[model samples]
Target: MPNSTTDTYLIGDMKNGKPFNGFFIYPRTNIWLIFDFYLNGKRLFQVYNDLLTASMVEDTETSFTAISNKNIFVNDRLKSGIEVTPVRVKKGIVDIARNVNNFRTTGFILTLFDNRSPEYIEIRPIAHGYELISTDKNTIEVTYHASGKKLVFRDLEGRVLTKSKRFNSDHYSITLEKLAYTLKYRLVDAESLERFVKEQW
Candidate 1:
């Protein structure tokens, strides 16, 4: 479903497969939209409502507060899950909020993958972010540097997944479907996703 307000902006072209996620604060819908694209032509998505709150918005202010000094313990509920599983982070974290000046949009994270094979994800820390490679060869390189004013992403296609910069409403935002079409990849809308979301939720 398309968002109603023009207030909606895209935070996409992240990666097409497992463990790779692209996210942004989509306020107009007040719903969590999760998407995943896979190499074997599989796709997964989920949606949730009413997760946003004043506290979460306030926390976005600190989402990118120099993680180099602290080993932050992230207790996030994520999508349809009701539990907060704590994941400790020592490295390989890049908070987009650090680019308050460069990126005006705000959003939370979303994961798109069926809990199946390609069992694990490998993360190698780079300059500002990390390089993520899945067992199935799905690769994504993320770099966000506010100080140097550099923000780049390479997901799936070895080269930059995005070839054009259409919207800077948040410093580089594009829809996943649009990006797929631009890349000449098939646009998939799984009908069973609605039932899948319910099953997972």
Candidate 2:
């Protein structure tokens, strides 16, 4: 692939001689904005969020800061964005394009500079409707929203662990045993979710 220079998130600058900008999408937040800038194959300037600015000398650094600006868009809605200062950064190098089974297991944990506790966290296998389960013998609690809402805090074997109150929202979560493997069970938003699953399966 030659790479794309023409996108909605990029801004052309003939004056500054910057040809293209790279954009990244935050899957959980549904936020899409400029992720990096390439000026003739050299990454001169890069921004993680809308607030902070960074420079790439040799392209080793993976983390960047997010700044509040009018250019940033979240969920296809415009807003006065806030700054995202990374509290922790992880570095990984792999060819995801070639190996279609690559799924990002861990993600960046970010805490705002002004806030003490972490505000934003990223996780994998996100979709409109999904269920997290422990692949081991441990029981996983869940509230399945089929035709009627049912709350069963139990494992797949129907061992009742706890009871949950009635909820009406499609967005929900249940914890999986940390030591055991987990599986997401659901097929919501088939067009986007199915394609991702097929590639990563």
For each candidate in turn, the TM-score is 0.22, 0.25
Off by over 4 Å in 2: 1-11, 14-30, 44-46, 50-161, 168-201
Residue 36 in model 1: shift from native, Å? 38
Cα lDDT listed for each candidate: 0.29, 0.30
After superposition of all CA atoms, the RMSD between model 2 and the true structure is 15.1
In candidate 2, which residue pairs get closer than 3 Å at backbone N, Cα or C atoms, i.e. clash? 49-65, 49-66, 49-67, 50-67, 51-66, 51-67, 51-68
Candidate 2 residue 192 Cα shift, in angstroms, is 8.8
- Model 1: colliding residue pairs: 16-37, 24-107, 25-106, 25-107
Candidate number with greatest TM-score: 2
**Model 2: per-residue Cα lDDT over 1-201, one tens digit each:** 133443433444433544444433322222223343445444433333421122222233443433322323334232323322211112211111100122212212112222221122122233332233322223333233446433334444556656432252222222222211232344222233223333332
Residue 169, model 2: Cα distance from true site in angstroms: 3.3
The per-prediction tally of clashing pairs is 4, 7
Where is model 1 poorest over a 10-residue stretch in terms of lDDT? 92-101
User: Could you tell me the C-alpha RMSD of candidate 1 in Å?
Assistant: 20.6
Per residue, candidate 1 scores C-alpha lDDT tens digits across 1-201 of: 344421232343334443333333233221122222221222223232212221134446444231211111123212332111122123221111110112221112212233331122333445555444433334454455445323244444555654444343222223222222222111111222222223332
- Provide the global lDDT of candidate 1 against the true structure: 0.29
How high is the lDDT of residue 97 in model 2? Answer: 12
